[model samples]
Target: MEKEEIIYGAHSVIEALKSEKSIEKIILNKGQRNEFYEEITQLAKEQQVKVSFVPQVKFRKYENLNHQEIIAFTSPVKFADFETIIESILSKKESVLFLVLDGVTDVRNLGSIIRTAECTGVDAIILPKNNSAGVNKDTVKTSAGAIFKIPICKVDHVHDALFYFQSSGIQLIAATEKTDNYIYNQEVNAKVALVMGDENKGISNATLKQVDAKVKLPLLGSIESLNVSVACGAMLYEIVRRKTQ
Candidate 1:
């Protein structure tokens, strides 16, 4: 069955309305009103998007989340072809910071990664259609609704996607403790795609071999590796920081 898409929080909902994206409806908390609420209402009216006010408790049931007094249920994030993603990066004149997950199945980890990706300004996140977590209620709640703002594309095979990006002049970098290369020292300015493996087994050898470079996050203590989400955040922001500097 197809899962529903949810966008919560007043700021996120407001942005969705202001943008050209399609919104199914706006679910606001009952008895809540102020400048923000009024503005959202007017904007929804102008856009002709339906608005439904429910009790805080009832609205919580829609997302099973702490809706922050506002929530917006929209259609699934629009998925596009690989050619579209490549064209988008080319048009923006931005070095691509693409993330490809091999087989990360945990919903929470995927959700957290989505949140971090949005904050780090990643170009797009590519995941395999099978053996990957699909965005749902828990994911939306865990992402704090940031999934609504980020673009997620599902591919038939991650390896094919990597090759497609590589052919486009995008370097594929892998994060694994097995590598001698340090992620912090890597040149992040080039058109690069960062590949993170699943939490349990890390990257498969077949996938690892395709990587242009393998990098590791420094472990200061006894811990061998960072959690998938944490490692992704560290690596992503490092790329962003270095590129902008």
Candidate 2:
């Protein structure tokens, strides 16, 4: 497996703590002083990973070290298979909430969106194998440790995943600016899959046609569009809010 780049921020390091992959080692600035240090030490102990503190300059060479003053090196990023994700979610027997990214290439956007999705009770996050950002240390950092808690599935073809979800009784709701139905007004009953498209293109015409419902966020600002992740948060919470109500 190809190794992903290392991440050195607190949130990214914490998410790495929760991942199943073995953390070969962790590095910290010598005599690191912070409330989060206790948690990091505890987590490292729990995972049986070795931790050591080096000079602050050493950590500064690789990590942001704004607060935690810690960095970690772990195994390569693992991408889950589509079937495995489907089977796992089905076995859980919970209401399905999937967040799909169509050509979202920004790592921070993907990470922030995943964080929001996890908070909103999304079951899985789906991305196309190509043209989509995969799990990286920066992504984990941006997600604030939420990346470890959520299932991220990368597929050869996004349309195949959508087709599979639809066959598995999940409804596809595409979040786009070019839609008449606002997300707040939509019915997200049954298993729901919410798709957020690229920042530049929005959803492709072909993909939009495959969606069961095309919903837009109510924009009351001078700005024409919201960031994809922010828009996704809005749509996802709406689903959670409507379902539980």
Candidate 3:
């Protein structure tokens, strides 16, 4: 196993976060009571660092080290800011295509989406920082390194990106069955933001209400719904086909 560079001490971990270091994961002591731990927790979240609250016994191997009940593993990947990337894309005088993910938490599914999005000419991917999956080794491996080829913007909320896209003339097209529209029925052109929802729950009611179009793939088999990644790939390819033909 490849050993990870671990950061011990609460203050050191916070400093790493403040410096915008690529932190892969942070494991906190579930039983340890510390005033600074909560602040560290919040900072880890703001930086999109994966966090885990394991039992104190899990820290036995690190008993010789001063972990302060908080240990952070450094990663090599970093994330892009949602607004900055979108603004840059909007500044360009050309059509834009974005994939917006809402509450797709599985890393493998996220990886598949990124792979397909990259192949389908998606300009960038906009994901919610909290509910969506973050870049990790599993996602990287699953994506077959395509994760690095695409630009992923992490926003505070999915709707924040959707609203901004709409205001900037990018149509917010969602993949959901709640509407009567099909993906093939709409003429996707110019600036377009394709929104994919959760694995089981589908798109959130709030998001579905605000999107410019709620489109779904026609279901003909006994399967009630397609996997989120598969469904997203289908929608992306459909858009590409429409654009080409």
Off-target runs (Cα >4 Å) in candidate 3 are: 1-6, 22-25, 45-51, 57-68, 73-75
lDDT of each: 0.80, 0.79, 0.84
RMSD of 2: 11.2
* Model 2 per-residue lDDT tens digits across residues 34-139: 7767778898877556677888777655543464567777644555677888888888866878888999988899889989998998888888755666466778
lDDT of residue 145 for candidate 2: 82
Q: Which is the winner by lDDT between candidate 1 and candidate 2?
A: 1
Give candidate 3's TM-score. Answer: 0.87
Poorest 10 consecutive residues by lDDT, candidate 3? 1-10
Candidate 1 or 3, higher lDDT? 3
Query: Candidate 1: lDDT of 110?
Result: 91
| Runs of candidate 1 exceeding 4 Å displacement | 1-76
Residues 1-245, model 3: lDDT tens digits:
22336898988998989997767678998877688888988988777777899999989999999888789887435667777878887798477789999999898999999999999989898877677775677777888878888788777777777788888888888999887888989988778989998998988999998888889999999999999999999999998888778
Q: Which stretches of candidate 2 lie over 4 Å from their true place?
A: 1-76
Return whichever of 1 and 3 wins on TM-score.
3
**What pairs collide in candidate 3?**
none
Model 1 TM-score is 0.68
